[model samples]
Target: MRTSSSALFGLGLVMAVDRLVFQPDRPISDVQQTLLGIVRRVART
Candidate 1:
């Protein structure tokens, strides 16, 4: 069995978002926060 790069990237993205949301106490740097905001906006559309 083989997974495409896009599939792996999507899996990693889901995992990262899961960690960030479920672990609020984990401090995120300003850059990361900005990126997250961008991602959220893009996701909405």
Candidate 2:
């Protein structure tokens, strides 16, 4: 099977975050929202 770079990056980020911080029992969608918020905040500066 094959996967795009973004998919791989997301998987790596999830694993790294789970290991380094609290394991999120919430849906993955929440993380997507948080990431989007961060990007938007950066862009406004």
The numbered model that scores best in TM-score is: 2
Candidate 2 residues 1-45, lDDT tens each? 145456556765875587457855756677667666765675576
Give every collision pair in model 1.
Answer: none
lDDT of 1 by residue, 1-45 (tens): 145456546755865786678866665564367556766775676
Tell me how candidate 2 scores on lDDT. 0.64
TM-score for predicted model 2 compared with the true structure: 0.50
Candidate 1 residue-wise lDDT at 34: 57
Q: Which residues of candidate 1, in runs, are more than 4 Å off?
A: 1-3, 24-45
C-alpha lDDT of residue 23 in model 2: 57
